[model samples]
Target chain A: MPGVKKCLQEAMAIPGAIGASIVDYTTGFPVAMTGAAPNEDHEAAAAGTADVVQAAQSRSLFVSAVPHDLLEDLIITTAGGYHLLRLVPTDFDSRLVLYVWLDRLRGNLAVARRRMQTLAEQLVV
Target chain B: MTPAKSPGPGSLLTRVAGERRTGALVVGGTPGGTVYLAEGQVTYAESAAAPGVGELLTASGRLAARTWQAALDAGSAQASVGRLLLDQGHLTQGELELCVLGATYDAAYFALAAGTAAFHEGVRHWLGDVVSIDAAALNRESGRRIRLLNEIIANPRIDTAAVIPVPRPPRERVTLTAAQWELLVHADGQRTPADLAQLLGRAGFATIQELRRLAALGLIEQPKARATDNPDFVRLPRMRGASAPAHRHAAPESPAAGVSIDLSIDVPLDGDPTRAAVPAAVATSAPPVSTSGDPPAERPRLDRRKPGAKLPKEIAAEPPQPHPGTDEVLLKRIRTALRALR
Candidate 1:
């Protein structure tokens, strides 16, 4: 059961991880952040991440017809990096998103993605 | 907008943080809230206008009332209730921290508004701190929330007014979040957003925000907007009665009783979330007016429904038929998604 600080530290330790932050998508602000950010401004990165999460959650364009099939994670790959957003599932309205930025050359997408899943689960239950 | 006159003493949070003090700043107003700081960083906050951490937990069924009571009794003395819950395995660290963050931002939004504040040194919140936030960051976040809300719809009075569904909604169909759906279904003409917030065990700010969203979508009646002659009864989804819910124009006035039963019992509190997710059928009935063609003197024109009424299960159980345009929209999305995959 990692506390919030421990969770962020663990996320930073992931191979090739450049930055990690837990954002309250509802409010569009980062609750806790660690390591380096995309623009050297975690605040801007947090806002950008929130816009994508909000669009995915609210728009039918991204939502599936399959009942109970909620969005799990999204991977936004760039020329040099991968931005992964894992939606934290809670019973109530936390609307938290665990976001990690990774360097494409150094990080294995499969490993980083899987590590985030474990981290997200451990962050809660 | 704050009055241009008598300048209120600004938030003490910044000054306190500068001194690295630990205490609470109680903002005074009609619906004021308190912000708790540990070493000048915000650890927790609670507003009378919003549900606190405990209510959020019990209302969501994450923690039972008795369990909360037990936690309170055990940890109240040390101001370590939050830690006690975590140690007892009642809630995880992330759950506690995020919830604290949610409650803190929400309370601080209001606390920052009621400009007058006085700081008491060394006071701590009973829900021991999980994470701390910078005073500037908290202020920035609150400002962002206020701006975002106004960007959606600018009426602050909507927070306190009775949420009456219009007799005729503007859109043929509107999408609602599960939270929005729950709010509309339970909205009695009498319950304000704050009242509904406590009943639902949701954050008051969240309720206000969703109401603003509903107002933006033109789903619920806007405060002091021209009277649609909205009857006291809720216009539940028009599936059950003889009335035509899909009538693009107002259906000829059916007795309000024909379409909706005035909620007699408090809709079983959080009795069924799956049921709450089902949107209320859009009702399009003519305004209930006296045969005299003039509105009644006493506005509660709708018939008083018998006590012990539950929204007919069929109204919620039957899935709405997909609108013809929806399939096309879905297909377009699929095409776009598939092309991206390729």
Candidate 2:
């Protein structure tokens, strides 16, 4: 099992990555974060993203036809970067989302999403 | 060796971490909380004042209680309950950590608050250590939380007492966030913020924060010291007989009193308005015969004005004659008494 730090390191290594964090969506705390500048407010980002994830999950209640699994990853594209969040399913609680902010010019959304899923699969804690 | 007397929570934790002691720091003894430390690091903390990780998990709708119990049964022999839950996909590692983090801090707040505590060596929690936090760091965080709470809420003790909701009049509506609404719906007069949190399956701290916010907004009230809290409560009732005539003669041209009379006159002089205004005016205008100051004696009278309480025909119809001081008092008492009667 890859530890949180190791997982974050690998996530940060993704092409065009600006920052990455394993966030606990339930409490909005980042378990680990890397590749962000000193001034970057990763905690605020984690909390804001957790709210987005919660809002998305709440939508599952109204939209009965689509299963929750279909929305495995939530992607938000900004002018300068791409923000990708993938849910990490676990045995106990699945309220975890791996968040990675990528430079739009250097990152490929398709590639980052696939890599994050693989990395999240190996996360132990 | 006898332990030092009256050591602060931080020093006690620092000493424990220095020795790298493993076991529980039991605070407040019987039905007290335990802060589980592993080699001087905090592995877990629990308090009777706060809910545990299991409660939080189930309350959050993340795990069923029975499933958790079954996992406990299965993992009991190996001391790997966390692992069992993990293996069964109850929650992700990050989620577990978050729960642990929140629960630890929640419990620690109460544990450290107890101040006087004892260390029990070699004790272990069945769930095992999901993650470890430095005791010193935990202490600092707890302190920071206390300070933050003080900043947000004037009286932190609202966490302990039952929060009676003071419903506003239909015209004077208050807006609430979803979380605040949930809290309000669950806030029966009997439940303290802590009790409400337990019932709602939310973080106790968050619930307390909401209570404080509500208190600041005059939405929720602590039952303690209710009578004297309002300056008007003390002054208004006495303004009756003596002060009434004296004020009427002295300030005949008073716009404030004139506005109040106008407001009362506009009350259609019908049904309950005439009756309501006289007694209310009398009740409020009557001079205080004695200042004995027993709250219980005043409680029933004050209770009538509570938000949810049925407003007497006159008081409801005529709105108290506009003595700003008396009006302010009337408004406050009404809100204070508006408990969710159930």
Candidate 3:
């Protein structure tokens, strides 16, 4: 079974990866994380991301087509870095999310997405 | 300003500072908790872990949006928040307490997960002290119970984001508390138990308890965890309509049978109008004989007796014959007899 440390290490290896975290979106709790950012609470980031996902899903426009499923992935590009949120499929109750912070200058968006997707498929809960 | 203790790295305040922002960080426990303020204002709070304050008030369907908006707009400063909510009559003390308990737990579970740095902020306000209770302990206990319930139900997937799939009804229609029924009915494949608590305006612990109980009773489907490569390995079950039982326990024989038993005991001669009429005749006949001495007193006694027996017969006979004139005559006779006696 691949553990959280392995996941974080692999996530960090991606070019320009600054930080990575495994988050339990439901409770906005960070199961595990790796990064170096002053005063940043990864747990809060996980929770805030969950909140963002919830806000997005609440729109009626998404309701008709999405089958009420959890968010599969979310990407937000900031001036300094890229924020990636990926929702991993699990039991209906244990909805887990991955939050990745990538430096914008060096990170390849397409490559990062592909790598995260592949990694997600192999993660053993 | 003895630099109110600088929140350590990863504390709630540090995170807020890192983001360079400010807003009330409401934390919830199980039954009750406290609120913390920053900069001479309310910043953090704790309540029960179930339906949060915002959700409870909205779900209750009693307070209006305008009232909530007004209270929030007034600011979350400890003193102001309470006074404003009270002034608007959005909630009574008891109701507010319940809401706070629920909200505190909800917020605390989420907030604690975010980090404990939240408590290290330079400025802090303890609403627990304000309310005259150990809000922290209450919230902590509630939070722990909710987490335990989540684990016991083994539905780790049903967190804040994942919606709860509806469960199949039981074959032997089981009895459920009103809250459990409501929870089941409201499971819209989108709201987690926590979310439902907020939507339903219930405490988080209560919601989890009901869910755990239901799952234990085999009334709901439990999700199985699947291995995946994703760093986030949790798997939320994809919800689909649950299968109905092949044979439903027949609806409980109407409670009317029990009601009938009560009725029979309450009214022994319900069916016999003639038997009921006999009492009226006896009473009237006796009243006439006694009228010579004190007609007024005798008349009232007769009047009271008449209703006990005569009213039933009258109701059975013509069904609606006793009208305004008869009632007037009866009153007049009683009055006249009283005057005669005086």
Candidate 4:
């Protein structure tokens, strides 16, 4: 199993990836992060991503009404970029999600979604 | 010029860091905690006010209580419990490191209040060292958190009080953040912020901060000190000095004396999870069974001690029973839900 740093590195390698973070949504803190420039407010963005995940999990409309309802992933598309969040499955009571920011011009949303799922499953932290 | 030379939480930590010492610093006094150092870096810390890592791991459903107990039993003497857990595949190396780091920071926050810390040479926690946190960095972060908490929460003491939900939310239509909603669901007027943190499997500081936010928004009632009403207080006099005047006067004041006595007994018993779990048959037999069916002999024995000294009849006869509280049951359900997520 890859550690958090390795997971972040792999995430950064994804096509058109601008930034990646393993965010603990419960506390709105990043477990590990990569790819953001030195001046970028990655922590603030990670905190915002946490809110997005929380909103999906808590709101009735966003929550899946199936018998075993759990959020799978979240995606946000803006004019310039795509934000992808995939929950990490863990035996521990951790509310962690892998978030990747992709440039709209270079990234394929479909490919990013599929790639994130694999990373989420394989990521060890 | 160097300021008052006192061996406090910060000074001791600074001293250890300067010396690059390896051992345990037992910080004692009110709100005391222990910080374990490995070559001047903090590897583990524990506070009486904060839940330990074992509790955090167990309560979070990441590891079962039995699993933790087994690790302690097996690896405590050797100081390789963390290694054992990692070797067993219970948690990955990264997960263990993160868990230890999170718990150390959480404990250090509450433990670093102004107080003298004593150093114990060569002592170490069983988990050994997965990662070393710089003492200076930890102090700064803890200070930052305190400042953040103070800014959000007007009253710092509210963190220790029992949090209760507003009986009627001020707004007819309200929107709650995920943390606020969870805090509301478990508010229950009984749990403090610290308890809520454990219940929710979140960091202690995070829970308190969320609670402060909730309070600021008036989404939840400000936490209040628990009521002074003590059921045990009444039981004290009744158990000792059977002819106590206060009891005689109190009994006459109540119209339904016999029924009230039973109801009062029920109230305290029901509130106590331990006593409530005892079967009726076993409970009824408990008082008599303690003295071998001789209350007279027990009375003399009890009288030898100070007044109100006899152990409550229920306590003396408290039987072993499965006493899972509501939160434990909820945590189990949460674990099941988490399993489904996996």
Candidate 5:
């Protein structure tokens, strides 16, 4: 959907956003992305992110008292930046996960979270 | 023997066309490669130079040895293994096609590289395919010079003769498709990619593709041949349960006893007494009967009630039919006759 592109662009436009991608959770495929990589290997990145998401999901299932479906978002802050994975379920078992790489220095965790929620709600998958 | 100069596109095509063989031909260079297979041709392809098709399939969790063997037998008898698996509903058409393409490409890539080292026409090796590929298309897609094949052969990584095991990354994770998971579960580490494909009822190409993908992900490493052993040989990990001997024995025994005594024997009897009764009656009635000599009793008839059959019968026996327009019909007939005569 054009909305996905708009959402990704909007996410990227955020002050500290380094890169953003819309990933399909089921197949671990990238539906859309906005970023620059040296190798330009978006497929590999999407696949890698998908794997990370799966691991996180499995971990949540094992450790948490809450049911698996309650898992909404995962945030990993690295020395370079913050990696946010937001799972958005749609009409079918098909799910959309918005992956945002935010520069730690400029990124406001609160604002990014709010913005991601708004964007995820507005996203028409 | 040193690999000869990489064949020109024209020469590769001519060779393929002249041979009129059906199977994928892979051309590798700096970037990547391509594969092409004829309708009925078979190819031998391996990934990581260590694990062959069987190992790849089993490692991927795709198929069990017994199940894979059954499919292989069926495939051999059927028209094409790829097509047969699809028809048997073991794999989807898309999966089959992908498997075929992937296996062919992987095999061709290794085979061409190996072929360059020591050229032999008739002697069949188990690692790569015998089919030819469209060399021009491969070079064009990969965007590499054809001459690079000769140089690539010199690198021991690509050479079958060296048999260096590709190093596997520790704690690396991979997201596998359902079929890939099945292959890995069944791998038990012994079967090669080709063997796994046959057992899993998957095409060779698909198994190889998964192996390559897994290798790229660094989950599995290729095996290296030792100085004491044959240089060209590659070894895969031992089967899944090989290391845990006690667990292997204990695991199967518990499951076997529990399942056999608890579920297998009791479940059907407890759940469907009728099913057990029917079989028992059949067995008791024919003690010394030859299973092949006599046809089995006819399968229990299904309740064959046609969709609207009951409705029609109900409607038919309801009551006397109504003659709504008898008087009107008689009046209309009189009027029509009068009009016609006039």
Candidate 6:
């Protein structure tokens, strides 16, 4: 199944993957989640990802100066893990955000970002 | 409304899941629905209020109506329509699953509402299972949707009442989502959100959310504001002790509820839409022709709500000579400023 659940399963397969979740940032709701969480709670982690994504889209400090340009993704680095959030763009209101927690020392940030971009694309169709 | 001994649909589903049961839980209500679970995970749900996955797919132009019907006829009997759609290449694996996911959650939101439920053993949804939502997540999401709707507009009346757009919005420019624009275009001040949802072939609850958002932004007429028929009538807040109706309108009571909605928007003040949401009156200036049931002569508004301030043009327009109520706008501001100081 080339779907969100399957995509999340694939996200966990990425080396050093801790946890994964798909969130609707518009209301800070998690569409589906899997794997480990920063606080050992997927809902809380999903909510935090939504907040960061919301800020990136609305706040001038994080928003780009380009006209009508949308944000691609956001990554928060901690000593132990890397929290990656990739936005899913759709024809309709696509406030859907994808988040994956990665072990900092074991995971490759570049590889994780590329994999998430692919996962985000799978969600739209 | 008393199902005191009976478990709600939410808890029923939880119990079903705990037992690893497979069947359909039918919720009987005005617009009742059914939840199809596989081994306790919610595989699909359908509500009378919302368009099902088939309707959602066809309405969005992704799948043809004939194709959907064909798939249904082919796989509905064995409860494998989802697999048939994928096998027939009518919908991709991702499309089928995502649609099922969205439709399941959307329907479950309404299905889990206050209703009596009965479990039919071994019954199945024609669409079959694609993606499943655990009972906990399903409960949380539904609860969140309810909270989000109430948070958008405190008054419950707007959800059930007819959606009526203000005849003449006080603002010069207004922003709205495309879905909201469509709902407004179709609003006849007669059809409620549920009615509009079926008419538009959109998600039922999503339309309700949009309507509430529109009301919060003052784009649609509030149920209480319907009394003052004329949008141009600036129905000032009645003086506290004045002979206003003893029954308070639910809309204004929103802020007085101790929990304030952060209506202090961060967007620019220019062309703000919240202006029309001011208490009862939506007009920026005094009605030259007071078509309202209550004439300006006796029920003149003395308060200036920041919501209805047409500052830029009012400064350049002719003086307020015809309507005496316009002058009180300044006085009300001064009074408010004084109160703020204290």
TM-score top scorer: 1
Worst 10 residues of 4 chain B by lDDT: B233-242
Better of 1 and 5 by DockQ: 1
Native RMSD of candidate 1 (Å): 13.7
What lDDT would candidate 3 get against the real structure?
Answer: 0.49
List per-model TM-scores for chain B. 0.63, 0.64, 0.47, 0.63, 0.35, 0.64
lDDT of 3 by residue, A1-125 (tens): 24446777888898989888766554554555789431476646766876766555556554445456544688988888888877664311234567788989999998898888766655622
Instruction: Give every candidate's TM-score on chain A.
Output: 0.95, 0.87, 0.85, 0.92, 0.83, 0.92
Fraction of the reference Cα-Cα interface contacts (below 8 Å) that each candidate reproduces: 0.53, 0.06, 0.00, 0.34, 0.00, 0.32
* Full candidate order by TM-score, most accurate first: 1, 6, 4, 2, 3, 5
Q: Residues B1-342, candidate 6, lDDT per residue (tens digit)?
A: 426567888888888989999999998764567888889888888776666776677656677868977786787777788899888776667666666776777778888876788898888777777877787788878888888889889775576555668767758988665678899987754455665665566777778778888888889866542221221112232122111111221224433321221121111111332342232232323444344556533533323334445533432333223223223433432442342233
Candidate 3 vs candidate 4, TM-score winner: 4
Question: lDDT, candidate 1, residue A61?
Answer: 84
Q: How displaced is residue B270 in candidate 1, in Å?
A: 31
- The worst-scoring run of ten residues by lDDT in candidate 2 chain B lies at B231-240
RMSD of each: 13.7, 13.5, 25.5, 12.9, 24.6, 14.3
Can you write out model 2's per-residue Cα lDDT over B20-132, one digit (the tens) per residue?
99988876532246788888889888765566677677756678878976886787566678888888887666567756776777778767764467778988776788888
Tens-place lDDT per residue, model 2, A3-122, is 566788889999999999877675455655787832487767876887888777656453346445345888999898899999876543235788999999999999999999898777
Kindly report which residue stretches of model 6 are placed more than 4 angstroms away from their true locations once superposed. Answer: A55-71, A78-80, A90-95, A123-125, B1-5, B170-173, B198-202, B224-342
lDDT of 4 by residue, A2-103 (tens): 666777788888898999987767556665678882249766776688788877887789776576567889888989888899998765445678899999
| Residue A98 lDDT (model 6) | 81
* The TM-score obtained by chain A of candidate 1 when compared with the true chain A: 0.95
Q: Which regions of candidate 1 deviate over 4 angstroms? A: B1-10, B225-342
Interface RMSD of each: 1.5, 5.7, 17.5, 3.3, 13.0, 3.3
Q: Rank order by lDDT, top first?
A: 1, 6, 4, 2, 3, 5
- The alpha-carbon deviation from the true structure for residue B125 of candidate 4, after best TM-score superposition, in angstroms, is 2.1
Q: Using Cα atoms with residue i matched to residue i, what is each candidate's TM-score against the true structure?
A: 0.73, 0.60, 0.37, 0.63, 0.31, 0.69
Give lDDT tens digits, candidate 5, residues A11-93.
Answer: 88777997888765534555557885214666566667777876866563534664553557878887877878887644211
* Between candidates 1 and 3, the lDDT winner: 1
* DockQ by candidate, in order: 0.42, 0.14, 0.02, 0.24, 0.04, 0.37
In model 2, where do residues sit more than 4 Å from their true spots?
Answer: A1-10, A22-31, A34-37, A40-105, A108-125, B1-5, B29-32, B74-78, B88-92, B169-171, B222-342
